[model samples]
Structure formats: structure tokens, C-alpha cells
Target: MKIERIYLLFYGISFISAHVNAFDPITTTLAVGIGATLGSIFKYFQEHCSSKWISFNSTGLEVDLENKLFGQHIASRIISKAVNGFMNNDNPKKPLVLSLHGWTGTGKNFVSKMIAENIYKEGMHSSFVHVFTSELHFPHASQIEIYKSQLQQWIKGNVTNCAQSMFIFDEMDKMHPGLIDSIKPYLDYYDKLDGVSYRKAIFIFLSNAGGESIIQTALDFWKAGRDREEIGLSDVETALSLSVFNNKKSGLWHTSLIDKNLVDFFVPFLPLEYKHVVQCALAEMEARDLEPDMSIADQVARDLIYFPKSERVFSVTGCKTIISKLDYYV
Candidate 1:
């Protein structure tokens, strides 16, 4: 038997829309019975897969969600700052931990997970994973609706920024103010918040706002005046990196909107130190002796990631860098 296709609906809730079936009563009854059974099976498969998101590649790094929480955190200098900051903050609410990275950088996705994993391992309900950006409640109305309402109220409170956090909004700089406002409760904050793990929760809002956008907007206007001028004598750079296109040139995209205040909201939580961590991680790999067997990109990646107590120190971004950087190390 050939199976044509599989459609999985995780939410399970189905909206059946039917006008009186044009079929006779016996045929209509049969159709209804088949539809209900098919729908339930689809939802079950979707739910089964929804339980995990793993990052595995032949290149060496394996990031499993389970290992991250059960193991102690791995820190680079940037992570060290967060850990130290976490320990020192006696304030009832936790500091909002935010991180920003342009395209080509998976740091937002990578870093935020580590932070939440830390919170959960510290005795927080494993179910609290519900609060993460990749929540399993995706298509669920009741769980998602209730979570959003609580988060909205929490955002309005002016406690620590880590009060029930939001996600790693990909290209937030391109979003409209109206759209920003819709998620305002998730991004901006007021005072006197509660239930947030001021000691644990963090809002990691990543963006290319000031660095990429402002630079391009300025370049666009500068280039306009120079089109009539001769080349090489030009004071402005006319070319753009593909990374820049992936990271910055999203203003025209209807879906790429970010709150203008996102940076300000997250600046306080930004990592204070990364240079030493980057340097140390590099050193750890250099000491490995096996680094000579890899490429430059892999070498760079090797130095970039921190090995958790339960897992290896390889990651997707670092994997490419490892291959590229291998030559230098060898």
C-alpha cells in the first residue's frame, strides 16, 4: 500500500465546516465517521514530534534539549557575566537577559535556550518550559491563550526585565509600531511585577537595529549623491555583504517588524563580557591536539562554543567556522 501524504495537526481542536452534504443520508453518515477518525490520528502524530527539537549534524556538535537542563551550564566570558549577574542580583525579580545577533549568527537561538535550561534545572517546573518561545502549545487555544494573558500582565509590571520572557524575534527592526504595540506587553515593561524569576527569567530580544540598519540607511543616501561622481574617489562603500542583506535589508518585508524600543529594553541584560570567553574557548580547542585534524571554520567554532556538563561543545554556527578555521590551526 502506498501512502500518499501525512498531515499532522498538533492542536487536535478541529473546526468542522459543513453545509448539508449533497450526498444521501447513508453516504453523509459514512463521510462524517471517516473524517473524525482521520483527524484524531493526524493530531497524535503531530503531538509526538512536537516533544523535541534537536540540532544534530555530521560535523560533530550535538545539541539535545534534555542534556542542557540536567547538566550544569557551560560559560564563556559572556556567559560568565550572566552567571555572576544572576548570582549577585538580590532584587526579587530577575534581570532581563537579552542578546542580539544579525543573520548568519544563531547565537540568539543558542544562547536563550541555555538561559532557560539553567532556570529549569534549578528546580523550576519542567512544565514551565511552556513559557519558552518554542512552546508545545503552538496550536493549542486554551494553553496558549492563558499563557499570553499572563505574560501581557507581567510585561506591564516594572520589575526586572526577566519577568516572564519573550522570544528571539528574528528581524525585529523591520516591524511597524502598531505591530510592536500588539506585542508591547511582551517587550516593554512597567513596575511592581510578580511571579517572574527575577532570579531566573530573562527576555532575550536579538536585533541588528543600530549597527546594520542605520549604516545602510546612511549608505543609501550617501550613495545617491555619488552615482554621478567617479569611482574609487568615492568616500562611501557601495557594496553590501550577503550577510548584511540577510541581517539588515528586511525593512521591505511585511513580516519583519521589531519594536523600536527593543534595544533599550534589552540593553540592560546584554552580556558584559565575551572577548575572554571567546579567547578561552579558542584556547581550549587549541589544546585539544585534535584541532589540527579539523578546518579553520571548525577551529573557530570549537573556540566559540562552551561544553555543558552533559554535552559536547559543538554548535551549528561553530561547525561552519570550525571547517573554515581548521587550516589556520593545523
Candidate 2:
């Protein structure tokens, strides 16, 4: 009888221990579910709050444009107009089209990047921002047809998904002929066809087609002892447009986008001078977490080759070579 009572006591203790040690499956599941729910709510708020802030603020964008190397006025004006237009309730019903033309290293790509950075929170990495390079994306002339179809579908699909899309075409001077025309439809006016509206989208083209003309104009101003700042859009507008239209190698040479006056701005990026090269060097140095050194910057600028063998007034390679030159100096 005492053994039986001891066994009953041991069994009771064991049962109590099991209840204390093991968690209730339903309660544990509820705890895990609550944690997951809290995490999702936090993520949702984080994304929405950030997006709201970016969509409303333009100060960051304005400052970025002002800090760019060159084409300050034109870039700022056109970009502001585009951004404001996008933000405004009553604005034009067309896509903001900008064609950035200049020699290499003259800030065409830089300006594009700045615009992307300020306009979109994700910048060039944004899912809404699509970049197509001629050499890398559409190299083969024979594949132009396939490229055209793909480009159209891609644009349509993305725009349908999100109207605030940005498309950037780089190395446009190397793009195949008749391929850019595929996008002409999207750029043109359309009154909600198939429930797709592309007016809110932005298109940017970067090309070297008018590089020579721009250099010549700047050179003439320099020879005439005119201030480089005096060189206005009016001075190069006609010549630059004509050059691009006439050049067979240019992607927009025979395209309707040019002929139809669909291109809103033909922003010219002038070649960088010695001072600009120094600035670029300093900027690059600063970017690398290095202190800015005038001596190193000056040496780097002097090492660059300038144009007009006799005059040598401007850097032939512009800021394009500044980074490489800094590698040696710094």
C-alpha cells in the first residue's frame, strides 16, 4: 500500500513536470503569428512613409542639379519644368522628352544620373527606371526587329503596371536605325488607348552625335575672346539639331521623334575646361574619402590633353580622364 501510494505520487509529479515543460502548440503559434504580423505592419509603414516623403520633396533634386559640373542653367530649368509638370494637377499631356547631346565626359551621363537620383528614391537602381545601352543591349543590326518588339512590349508592360516610369537610352549614337521608331508611338499623344496612359513617363536620350559642332562653337567663342558663360542654348540649338539630324550614325538621324518636334529639349553639355577638370578631380578625391588637395588636382588637370594643337585652350578629353589621372596623382 505504501509502494502504491509512492508510485501514484511519482506519476502525479511527472504529469505536472510535462505540463510545465512543454509549451501549448496553439499559444506558440499565436505568438509567432503576432510577431510576423507586427513585422509586416512595420515594413508597410516604412515603405509608404519613405515614398510619401520622396514624392513631395524637390529641394534635394534642385540642389543636385545646381551642383552638377556644367549646363547648370539649362539643366536646372528643364528638369524643374519636368518635375513640376509631373507634380502639377493640370499640365501638358505628353511625355517629357530630353535629348542630351555632347562629347564624352561632358556631363551628359552625369546629369542623367543626377536627375535619376533626385527624381526617384532608388535612383538609377529603381525598378521604374529602365536604362538601355546601344552596345550592350542592342548590338547586332540584324536583331533590330527583335529589339524593337521587345522594347515596345517592355515599355507597354511597365507603363501599364506603373505610369511613372523612366526610360534612358545611352550611347544613342550607336543604336541601330529604325529601332527607336518603335517608341515613337508611346511618346506621341494618345487618349487612353486600351487603358494605358504613357504621358506620365519620361524619356531621355544620351548621344555624342553633335559633339564636334558643340566643340567648334565653344572653340570659336574662346578664340573670339568671349566669356564661356555667354555661350547660350540659342548659339548651339540650331547647329546641334541640324548636326544630329544629318548624321547617319545618330540613332535619331531619320527618326520622327526629331522631325516631329517631339523632343522637348536638346540639352548640350559643353566640353570641360581646365578648371572644370580640376573640379572633377577634387570631386572624385572627395568621393574616395580623401581630403581635397589643390596641388594634386592641379597636376591631374595639367596632365590632361587639351584641343586645337596650337591653342590648347580646353581639355580634349574633358573630365572623362580626371578619375584616371587622379589614380596617379593621389
- In candidate 1, what are the lDDT values of residues 90-168, reduced to their tens digit? 5523334444433223234445555545444321233333333322322243454554565455444423432333334
Candidate 2 to truth, TM? 0.84
lDDT tens digits by residue: candidate 2, 100-175: 9888888878877877777677777777789999999999999899999999999999888777778999999999
Q: What TM-score does structure 1 among the candidates reach? A: 0.35
Cand. 2 Cα-lDDT: 0.79
Task: Please give the distance, in angstroms, between residue 249's alpha carbon in candidate 2 and its true position after superposition.
Answer: 0.4
